[model samples]
Target: MPFTIGESVLFFGIISLTTIVIRFLPFILFPENKKTPGYIAYLGRVLPYTIIGMLVIYCLKDISFTASPFGLPELISAAVIIVLHLWKNHTFLSIGAGTIMYMLLVQFIF
Candidate 1:
């Protein structure tokens, strides 16, 4: 199905407005002059670790220790991520390298 010109304009207009509102909503909610609420501040401090824990659990939930690979790929990838993060203190580098390593292991090695 092809969108008519007016429909396309409306669609793009809605997307643009949504993007702008999302980008500015944080500043509008948490102004520079006002102190952040204690709970929000606490969440900001704690959510990263919580989310990482959740992701780790989710990622490893399906592993079968009795299987052929025996979770070596995940273990090695996690080790690489830990070492890279510790050595360089860079989250993106560690996560990206770990993901690439896992893919390569799954495709070629394991």
Candidate 2:
């Protein structure tokens, strides 16, 4: 595709519009002043864990224990995630730190 003004604007406009709707839809559905339904609140609480579980499963799916790295980087990073999460109890911090550690290990050591 040509990087022309009209084409770029059309593409970005669609993306921006979609982003706005996705962001605003939550607020529209669950107003801050109003109480959320029990089911929705329950789902909100469990969704993070569900996503994390899915990511862990996906990450481990392609691992080859017999290969060179032998999954050491992944295992060590997972340990970091577990330890950080347990010690600090901050999900984002744990995930970010673990990701950085994994990247460093893979790039430098394994």
Best prediction by lDDT: 1
Give all candidates' CA lDDT scores: 0.93, 0.92
Best TM-score goes to which candidate? 2
Residue pair clashes in candidate 1: none
Off by over 4 Å in 2: 33-35, 54-71, 81-104
lDDT of 1 by residue, 1-110 (tens): 38999999999999999999999997899888999899888987999989989998897998889988999999999999999999999989998999999999999999
Clashes of each: 0, 0
Worst 10 residues of 2 by lDDT: 55-64
Local lDDT at 31 for model 1: 87
Q: What is the lDDT of candidate 2?
A: 0.92
Candidate 1 achieves a global lDDT of 0.93
